[model samples]
Target chain A: MKITVSEKNGKEINVWFPTWLILNRFGARITWQVLKKHEVHITSRQLRRLVRAMKKCKKTHPGWRLVEVSEHDGGRVVIDI
Target chain B: METIGKRISRLRREAGYTQDTLADVLGITPQAISKWECDITCPDISLLPALAKALGVTTDELLSGKSESEPAVKIVPKDERRDIGDMMLKIVVDSNDGDKVRVNIPMALVQVALEMGMELPQVSNKDCLRGIDLGEIVNLVKAGAVGNLVEVESSDGDVVRIFVE
Candidate 1:
């Protein structure tokens, strides 16, 4: 599944396969160990700051819909990234 | 019990004796000398005199734990007034889909953007368009998603203004 960010200026930033960007932004090393658990990919431009900001904002407001993403396991997810 | 690790380490160097050399003079293993400095073990009472002589210090100085002192840390007054310039920019992007995204760039991030060749405005909270579009705007907002911006007007004389280019 993919997550899309709609900007205030009538534009959309589409984010596909957010796992890589998520883990990378959270400073989780994208190794074979993580890949075996879940799959993720992203665009050429890295989303390090984007994911970090999302996580930081989420800490204050748990319901801010800045970037929406899909989860695989449907388990209890704490969105640190 | 009062052996100072740093003091021992410093005295060892001043003596110009390698661990093995000191150990040889003291009739002990080099590993034992290492442990003494590392504080893993202490020297025997009888060995204090020889150790002090070799280390160029009196037994009182070594065992008493007095050595080179450190500078006292000066705590700055918490109330020192810092005037962050009053410049603030509020970018509220409302997409055709009805999602309104607002980003309040902090002074630090604004300075960072300026350093990266982005144009920033002078005066407090003046809005400057650096050719930032919707997609880029979203990305920038997403990058700064963690911070909440409080719009401060330029009237407040003591303030820091961040220019976004």
Candidate 2:
């Protein structure tokens, strides 16, 4: 994911994050535990599907400028996935 | 126009069924299957449903050589879709006092937080943000929806918009 915020004065803040999702089998265990802690009882099979969905979502698509909005004052915000 | 024989042949081949296999599934003879594929004859109306089922297609598809108008599966191109986990939930607030607030959180975290009953008082102590349910938004996302999930303009001129991208 990448984010850019630009002000009228030309100062820009750019932030980029890569490989934030590590939803492998190991992560599935931890995820199940975490969700269980919150009293959400999901089966391991569902967790595995979640891991696969996350992997498919990230691996198939990259660097999409999903959101870009400009304010009346010329400040702009853009988010990419 | 394509004939029913050609349709049956094409669907049969696409389904990996040889004439003998298709005949076996339909309780018919391979000669009948061969004749149909060769456009020598059409299946009897009584066997149209059975033949369609054997070929893993609708009777309309069998007769018309075209898929149903509403297909069971539609191929969506990769670029035309964003999977749920890859999406981000964005919350934007503009206060009447001229403070602009923008917060972006990944949809995965929002799911976890929704399960945890999390709150975002910092964004707005008002009832608008507090009253909104994240699970409903997530459900909308699962239904193949994007864009502004919630947009509220208060009487006081405070604006709040929550969207998924």
Which parts of model 1 have CA positions greater than 4 angstroms off? A1-81, B1-3, B67-165
Tens-digit lDDT string for candidate 1 (B10-97)? 7888889888888898898998888888888888889999988889888877777643342122222445422222222344433333
Residue-wise lDDT of candidate 2 within B1-165, one digit each (tens)?
577777777788889998888888888999988898788887899999887787778887777666666542233354676777777777878878666666666677567556545554423445667667778888887776777768888889989888777
TM-score of each: 0.27, 0.38
* Candidate 1 per-residue C-alpha lDDT over A1-81 given as tens digits, one digit per residue, 9 for 90 to 100: 245544445466555554445445344344323432433333213234434433444454333332222222221111222
Best by TM-score: 2
CAPRI verdict (incorrect, acceptable, medium, high) for model 1: incorrect
lDDT of 1 at A34: 48
Model 2: runs farther than 4 Å from truth?
Answer: A1-81, B1-80, B120-125
Q: Please give, as one word, the docking class of candidate 2.
A: incorrect
